[model samples]
Target: MTEITTAQPRSLTTALDIPRPPDLSWYVQARQPVGYEVNLTRGLLNPDNPALARSVGADGYTSVRTLVVVDKVVDGLYGKALRAYFDAWRVDARWKVMPGDEDTKNLEQAVEVTAAMTEMGILRRTEKVVVVGGGVLMDVVGLAASLYRRGAPYVRVPTTLVGQVDAGVGVKTGVNHGTHKNRLGTYFAPEITLIDPEFLRTVEPRHIANGLAEIIKMALIKDASLFRLLEETVAGIDGDALADCGPAMGEVVSRAIAGMLDELEPNLWEWVLERSVDYGHTFSPSLELRADPPLLHGEAVAVDMAVCVALAVGRGLLSQADAERALGLMVAARLPIAHPVFTPELLEVGLADAVKHRDGLQRLPLTNGIGDCVFVNDVTGDELRRALEFVHAYAGTRDGVRDGS
Candidate 1:
């Protein structure tokens, strides 16, 4: 008689035809971006994402503006396991939690949260903080950290897949305005990013899928081989295997994220950040902005990819067949190809806002071909409107060709 151990990590095999040897040098910073403190725990899955403080060994500096949230999730940092981390270290903390506060991926709430922390003098320079939940917590807490003391050190322990793969790695952090996602934010990097795959075992499936969407975006935009790896094995893979990306696909992704952030690191004020808009976001952020409650930043970005794919076809940037190849992959993964409830008014609003928010200085990048894309801010109102209408029709299934674009 044999028994499978319950604690064994899952595994899968799908060979990706990587064409070029990855440049290991791309990851090396001339001067380290900044020193970080990461605490990765073994066996025990804790609710708090910031494991660095515990791993820092000795009593590190207490946070001036510790943005604490009242989390009742037994699976999150707000739960009992986090108390154990504090107990292990035996450090006393002055923290407060406000109940009944709904968590939103919105900026208004972020502003309010930051103001409350500032008023309490909980946020200050020289002290570091710990943000406890998923991406929303990171976005709000990170923004608060950046604003307080004009900037303070904070560590992130991402509790969700969406947070780990995308938001958690990138230096970008922000709060949404009205319907616009991340309209208010900064390029502040964290003091450390801790990943505890144990926490992901408790994540909901839809959230995991959303995180995969961002990962796919990075793959599709940069490497065909990586996209193939995701397309072939995403579904059958267990939750922990997905989170174990530390070995599976973490390096390639880290480089891409590092590259993307480096492009903005030099221009933190966003003076040149728009130089990398890369087509998918123009409509994506607009859809997010036009959303009354604002769309999930990732969801809106998925829909934006649809709009850009169609425009790529219209502008002779991408061949119809190539566009279909990308579309098929997204559909196979069950991602939203278009916004089902999007309207003409909403589309117009989204596009106009994207254009208004940008400087006329340069055009953003759009995929013109495989492993290669282009940026030309010359996108016209007519072409952009048509792209939106196509998205509208496709998502509604009004024309049974949503993925066709």
Candidate 2:
């Protein structure tokens, strides 16, 4: 973990088990759905979608480097969006293909890729880079765009379920080290985000479940309606299920997008940054870091949320029943509460890494109840170890270990 400094939120705090609702009495959910004007249109391989070009015109972008994946099925669709958007727009546009996964986003990889693209004369100062893909593509391109000549405008066209609902749209950018996830990163906002749910048809169900975890986390933090929807609508998201078939799916997704709009408006620099919104994720990167090959980003976060909920129970912050019920829904939705094979040793390391990566929090805002949480930064190291051990054992991921001897 890089010895990063931790910043405390403007809030009250208490003992480990005492969760409290945020003081949002003065805050109201915005009227226009919490985001900027969105043109979520549908079209097939059209060369003049105009939405992209129109966004450029409105956002004042001059040069553009559109990057995407060639392997995914939706590549053709994105290619269509890009080709048409580029041809119709008067702004300078370049297309760069980025490699996938943690490796490509590494500092060296980002340095090399950006330089090569520049050598090819595809990037410039007058334009911003537009990234099109799932989370991995977004992070790599987001990081590159942030550093390219200091900074440039960028837009996101998230094509996967996880990308669409969670990681891609967020301006949190980073590359991972061997066992540490998102070890290097920055906070840069995208100029525009174009989310089209129709793209989910091409995504794998596991990946869809991965995205669902984050939505469920959002529900845990803010919306009970979303929690109920996940409980009723999610039966078997894996195998041969269209995960988004239920009305609950649409309801939750709409609410999330609305929340996104609230913070991402007029440039994403305000109070709604990813850290403030990503509750359980503060520990998730560490859990993934403990994995030999590391779990997928969403997968690790789902597991982390499970443990987080349980810890909330142990600390008197959340009810045991609530934790169980949430875990049950996650399991039914086919998300894992357990790692492939978790051990106390690995868990200790994960906890330390999680806390370290988060810069020795203030633990993530542990939920006292729906739309309620308390800031707790003074937990003993032993307590966190015990919490991790107990959850892992209960979920059959490890042997039962009490919360400290």
Candidate 3:
């Protein structure tokens, strides 16, 4: 027994291949139907109407409270009035005001918001959290709602045009982490998204143009009619014009909202890699986060879209005239079509990251014309460099005009 030497374990090549019933072959699947309304209304915060209470589910239960996380700017503008409105409806409410800007949107801010909601004792499935602000606050607080006790009901009252038309309409919520745009996030739909054009009245002019960038993206990728509408009305879209919500502006918002819904609703979880909606997003994230002044989300997207247009033109998938028209719309909207941060090296890094994100292939969506898209996996690093240079030269011409040179 002592000399057995543990049976010498086993010979190096003694065992033959023996396969058993392969661990019970199976797959798991589920379907969760998430439906939310993105309502575009005016005067949403008016105390005379009980719509806010109804929208937040405060009218459904007396014991429940609507935990309101408001952007600092929104709070300054309507905080007292909002509190009075909630009180008039005899609805219990708690308000927490936080700064809502790209720089402030982070994991700590999200955690802070979640902690405040936690202190309010909101019920997971019943009581609602109301996030009132621009895109940044919506993202930060929406992320909080998604994390608290696993998931909680929330309503979005988008106060900015960008919030109403783009960020608020989608289910994705996120905050930047370590120089990465939306590095940590989750896709959690809101119970309702209340969009009031009235809020745009107080927004700065530059912000209005920021919102138009996303709409332009939708038009270029999927809706020719939308592209035409934008071409028809781009000159009239001043900051004040958006606030007025005239017929033209209404159609723009409606069509953009509808287009976004059409693209996003079918694949809310973003299971598809060749997403038309990712046309500008592939390169914008890095440009947005790494810029010296930290360019606005849509500004970076506009620049990225310009580069993609150049890439498409180079491939002969899009005509030079069509590319100019697409880019001209961005210029007419007063959106920046290029930035110094969008150098060849930076763009290459963004494209490489996007390739990884798209599951090891470049699922780059290029325009076939102004309104159709084709996903290509064959974009080379040289093509990306040339595209960046093309956008830079084009933007120089546009900037010269703005500078009155």
TM-score between model 2 and native: 0.74
Clashing pairs in 3: none
How do these models rank on TM-score, best leading? 3, 2, 1
Deviation of model 1 at 92, angstroms: 2.3
lDDT of 3 by residue, 175-259 (tens): 9889788889999999899888888888888888889999999999999999999999998887678878898988888999999
- Lowest-scoring 10 consecutive residues by lDDT in candidate 1? 94-103
lDDT of 1 by residue, 1-405 (tens): 898778754443224433444632345546434444433444433324334444333254542224344333523343565655565555443343422112365655556666766665653554456665677677777886777667766777677666766667657787766655667887777777776666766776656656666666666566566666665666654466655655545543454455445544566456564554344676666555545453455666667677777778788888877776666655555566675445456655666666666753335566666445667766676776787666555546532222322
lDDT (tens digit, per residue) of candidate 2 on 274-380: 24355667566665655655466777777777777777887898887787777777777667776644444554566566566556655556777755556566655
What lDDT would each prediction earn against the true structure? 0.59, 0.62, 0.86
Which is the winner by lDDT between candidate 1 and candidate 2?
2
User: Per-prediction TM-score, please?
Assistant: 0.73, 0.74, 0.90
Question: Which predicted model would earn the best lDDT?
Answer: 3
What is candidate 3's CA lDDT for residue 269?
A: 91
